[model samples]
Target: MSKVPANEDFYKVHLLNEWSWKLTTPLDAQPHTIDGNHIFEVIFEGNNTDTVCANDGHVELKFAISAMEQRNPRMPRLKFVRGLSTQFEFAMASLHTNFIRGRFGLQLLFVSNESVIPGEDFRLESLFSINDEVTPGIFEMVNIKLGERDNSTTSTLKSHSNTPQSSWPTGFIQARPVCYTSERYREVKASRDAKLSKQRTVLNTSDQELLLPRTLPYLFYAQRIKPTDDPHEVVGMRLQNISFGTPGDGYYAHSSFIVWTISFGFGEPPIDTLSPLLIGLITLSAVVVLGSLLFGTMLILIFQRRYRFGEFQRLTETDTTSAVST
Candidate 1:
């Protein structure tokens, strides 16, 4: 197929660096790690083949992860997936997320791409499947106020993170990868490993606590959702400094590519400005009310001044003096 000429028809998510994913079969017992001999490179954009993807009049971005699996790490521009020229659409139609609109969907599918050899140089297998259900955080518009604190019907996890969600500006969303599970453990695993997963991280986000009468029962944290230039533009997410383990945390502390789901806050972008017609109407109403009050007050004061000055003459006094002669 000819290359789709690069244009603004879609947005490209550029990464700071190349990231890789490795899996160990029988990860608990006899371990054999398969690095896949490929660096992961993916592109994202709105699925606009049929018209711009939209939802309830707002633009909905259905970004698909097109993984360009390469056999040689040095061949950065190599575009090959399962021996095909095009990259595999790993998680396109199925955008998996748990928290948004109090609903969730299984928007992901991946089966092992068997290598020519079983353990050595294994290439990951993939299938592009759809589940018909609307994928959570797949560019759905949300309009919840800062604390939706009165949201009892919302899930317990709707407010589970340590970030001050109440202070999260409008159009901010956490495209949290709810969970990563493998029917067979030989491939994918949870991004968070043994220690960090269980680690009780309690950030001191007492800024809101200062506004409260007393302390709140919540931990404080940051970086739960990545910030954006257009806070109300309803953007998805991309990560920098990707790694399996940090120099401090050591290797296997985390999996870089597992949680790389690019979903955005599902909500209505803020309507900061009122319509011009509405504003004009409001100004007119205010002027009319003020004018009526001022006019009434002036009339009342004038009447009081005349009456106090004894300016009222009786009707019988209006008769002319010539009436005496008649």
Candidate 2:
């Protein structure tokens, strides 16, 4: 295959550092059907093309990214580099708190063509066979809000993490590898093992607690759909669904690549119950209504004053004319 050109079509750029890891098995995005306060489902279909290789299998997992934002006011944005890539790996599992579990062996595929070309948006498609081996795992989709007294980032992560693993609303447990076996597949495994070990150090840290609240219940779509036009890219997610964090409680909102969307708040609330977004909307509407009424009253008073002055002038002129005639 010829080298894919970096052109206007790409909207995102993958800044891979020296320590970055890549996934050999590609993922596809499934369609979005259900909407809830704290749960989402994205199904992906995996594919395995190469044959006659040893590592033949299909696998899938439930993945989610913590929404982290910058502390600088002028530069509020989502931070994708956690010394980790945004792609979720499902194989080398070490239990994560709550419902989500991550594998140390997953790699992410980034877009070569960044342009937002129609039918060209990066997508996740169905995962399929690798070397004819079957992968395992049941994936459940869930959205979680922060708990009381939590930061936007922390609240979001805890909301999801608090859910019992046994209660994973949706996820995958795969026994088969989701890719085709190739002669060079062994190298991929070795690289994955090393990467997983390193990531384990980071994933097991307290810094993994940031999250934006408006996008609360961060939705995870299963990896089943792939970008149709470019194998270099996949399209399935509706970028329009991206939203800013609720600004009601002095929270700021913004967008970022790798994580796509994120939001922040000043302090933590009963995230599980506090709907700052809803409260904010109500407050804004009330302000607008009140302002409109005040403005309308002021306009009416001004017009009434003008009308009365004109009438008084007319009466005075009539009296003067009558006196003069008499």
Candidate 3:
């Protein structure tokens, strides 16, 4: 069938095959761009040309299956999507703004041609990170605490997830993101702006919240932090272990979404919340100091009372002697 939405460019889908894409639009270099592409070129479809633009160049995907099964027992899977469906949609508004939240936003949607099984979800491990490099002071991974909010309370993922994060805080301190220039990729660097310190990034309360990806309630957004340390780990988040769909569950049985908005090049990534261990230590110290003060106050009162009592007795004896002499 012909592609829908007449004004949009056609995107081809693939199944059981390795595919690539290149955007028809040429990369333009000027203000924020060094070449035709934005300095931090967000790429898709394993295609050098499919760079995401400020335009709502949303790509849509669907899956179709044949009755006749094709066997490839000898071939090992090199990528997750190779064995899944072929079509995909990278949806986002092409809004370009100076603010980090406004500048970059993207989402990937995947639907099933057939019902899926438990533990049979498409996933991409280590989506993006520079950890493969031998360079020093470099690693990758946005250290999301084990119990961070992986999904909304009403989200299917949250209900189905074995790990409950109802009590966990949705905060992350560090992530290593690399930007793609027209030429190549490079590691992100941290800034030593006066407002930042190792303990925290933003000095001002308003700016502190600015570090959060306030734009959307993304599934995972450790992609950009204002920058805790210069090195983003060898970690890029791609689709990972989405087991929401099942063959007989009905409406949502065959589809799952790998949705996230990029919070790159912002003022600072969200800073770390105080750990329980630190909070406990502070509380213990306060208790100790207060106990010492209370003990010292008691000793001072006792000494003062004793001194007054002894002086009063001496005065009484002197007055008695003077009366007898008179």
Best by TM-score: 3
The lDDT for every candidate, in the order shown, is 0.27, 0.25, 0.28
Best by lDDT: 3
How far residue 90's Cα lies from its native spot in candidate 1, in Å, is 20
TM-score of each: 0.21, 0.20, 0.24
- lDDT of the structure predicted as candidate 1: 0.27
Q: Of models 1 and 3, which has the larger lDDT?
A: 3
Residues 82-165 of candidate 2: C-alpha lDDT, one tens digit per residue: 212122322211112111221112233211211223333222222332211111121211121111111112111112247553
> What does the lDDT read for residue 179 in candidate 3?
18
Candidate 2: worst-modelled 10 consecutive residues by lDDT:
192-201
Q: What's the TM for model 3?
A: 0.24
- Regions more than 4 Å wrong, model 1: 1-171, 174-271, 311-326
Model 2 regions more than 4 Å off: 1-274, 314-326
C-alpha lDDT (0 to 100) for residue 45 of candidate 2: 25
